[model samples]
Every structure is written in structure tokens, then in C-alpha cells.
Target: MEQSLYPVEFLHFGIHLKFELTETGIFLKICVVNFSVLGLFFHRPLALNLKAQPGENVTLSCQAPDGVDIEWSRTDLEELQYVFLYRDGHIDSDYQHQSFKNRVELKDKEMKNGNLSVILKNVKEEDSGTYECRFKAAGEGRRKRAFIKTKPISTIQLEVADPDPGELSGCRLNLNSLTGFYFMLEADPEQTLCVD
Candidate 1:
């Protein structure tokens, strides 16, 4: 009796795959060689960069090998804002910022695809703080911080209250009332009097 068989093999970067065929069935084997170069060629997802203006819009993005879930929050706060969670190819609406209620929104709602930018309108000074973007995958996640800068309101001297005659000593002072009170200026150096 004569028997016939076929053998197959595949090789790539120290990874070897072999298949053996016999009369009854086929057997397969896969062998991986421990090599340092293989690790360098693999691609891995990294944290994304997020930033925004005090009263403007911003986005926090992340890229991962698989689907991702994002959560945004501040370091000082104990709770986290779920933001727009992208999972199962849809965004969950249960989580949203009350402060941003209707004024803010996320672009490319599919957070799993790496577009997690947030839009905010009429940003306030209190909103100028560090915001964190966290990405979750397979129960593991990473965090990145975003900074917001707000413009400070210009300070104007509203009024210079009238001081007692004893308070006016050696220096000459000018006063302006923000309430539109027109004070009379007297040149008398004897006593400081309030005139309006």
C-alpha cells in the first residue's frame, strides 16, 4: 500500500504556521519565536489630546486598538461626567453636563472612533480649569488632562469714597464715581468737604 500526504508552512517575523494532511484528517500547529523586533512593529493606541477655551468649545479624543468608552471630569471633583459614550455603534444619552445641558455637544458622537471633542458656548471664568479625558477598554482606561483659558474682566475704578478731613493728608487724590455722581471740586485747602 502507498500513502500520500501534503505539508504546508507559513513564516513571517519569527511566527511559523504549519499544517499537515493525512488520510484521516489534518493537523495544524502555530509557533511564535520570542524576538525583540516583533514588539516594536506592533501598533498600539495612545491617549488623545484635548483642549478648549473658557467660553468656547473643545474636544477630547483618544485612539485605541478596539472600541473605546470615554469619561470626562476634573481632578478636584469626585464624580466624573460620562460625556457622550460611544459603544455598540451608538451614543448613550443618559449622561450629559447640566451646566452644558443644551449649550454643549460632542462631535462625531461615536467616541469609539476617537473623536471626543466637546463644544461649549459662553464659557465663564469658573469654567477655566483642568479637565480630564479618560478612555476605557476591556475594564482598563487612561486619562489625559485638558486646559481651558478664560479672559479676565477688565477692572475699573468705580468710585473713590469721600474721606474725612483728617484722612486727606499730604497727597492729592482724584475721585470718580461710577454712579454718575458729579462731585464738586473745591480748591479750599483748609477743610476737606464733600460736595456733589
Candidate 2:
């Protein structure tokens, strides 16, 4: 009598296992595999659109569950660049991009509450781009050398524009009436207001 069982693959908790049965004997193989199946449980990145005037400051907010590792990066660049990184309860600046070196600040104390917002000072036209805020669980096993769980939790699209003389006149204008209006009121009104 001869019988063969087709190879079967099983995946659990980021681990992968394979089993095969042949007439001679049963064979088993186990290997670590990085799979996109892990992404099923993670929340999709939230999209935010923001605008700032040149030389102003802007804050990008990213909300995550407490105790998770957070990483902020600029995704619209030619090369992926880290704007800021927070892991294991502390900020890691070694990987921060040179452009963001002195311009980015994180709300470290609010991290305990699952807030990982960053402030970008002296916003300029060059700062306009897509920014990604990612998060990973803190206790991913150190033994796994190839798997990474970092997933984007937020995506911010920032636009920096030169202040318009008439628009900055402190008049209460309806945003609904103005098509494509993007600036948010979070900076010093005096500095943002344009004097003719």
C-alpha cells in the first residue's frame, strides 16, 4: 500500500510550519516567514490634510494605543526618511533625517495616553509632503530576525503656501464658500496675519 499526503502549510502567531506525508515516512518543516496576514488586525492609516504658511509652525497628530512603538517618516521623498522615531519609551534620534533634525518635537509625555503627535517648527515650502506615522507592538520577539510589524497608523499631507495678503485679514470667512482652503488656525494670529 502506498499513499502520499500533499504538503500542508500552517501559520500561527507569526510562525510558519509545513508538513508532508509520504509512503516512506512523515516529514515536518518549520520556518519563520514574514507574512502580510499580520496586517489584518492593524488599523488602516488615517488620512489628514493640513496646510501652513511659510515660516509658521504645524502639528501633526497621530493616535495609537498606549505602549506601542511609534515611527514618523516622510514618505513622499525619493528615499524613505525618518522624521522621528519613538521606541521602548524613548525617542531615537539617530535615524532622524537631517532636514528634521532641529525642527521636529514630539509630545513624549502624552505618549502614555497613546498620543504620538509631532510639532514641525519653521514650516517651509520644502516641508510639504506626505508624512507617515507608524506603530508596532512593543513585545515582538527579539528572536525573529526578519519579521517587522511596523504599520502605518496615520498619513498626513502637508502643504505650505505663501501667505496671501487679503486672506490673512482676520475676517471670519466660511470655509465652505472658499474652494480648496487648507490652512488651519493653530498658529499665532499676529504672525500669520498679512499686513498690506
- lDDT (CA) per prediction: 0.40, 0.67
- lDDT of candidate 1 at residue 162, scale 0 to 100: 34
Candidate 2 lDDT by residue in tens digits, 44-120: 45789998878888989887666666678887644434788776667767757788888888865667577889899
User: Which candidate has the highest lDDT of all?
Assistant: 2
Task: Point out the worst 10-residue segment of candidate 2 by lDDT.
Answer: 1-10
Query: Clashing residue pairs, candidate 1?
Result: 55-123, 58-118, 59-117, 59-118
TM-score of 2: 0.59
Give candidate 2's error at residue 9 in angstroms: 23
Q: What are the RMSDs of all candidates, in order?
A: 20.0, 12.9
Cα lDDT for residue 147, candidate 1: 19
Error of 2 at 138 (Å): 1.7
**Model 1 clashing-pair count:** 4
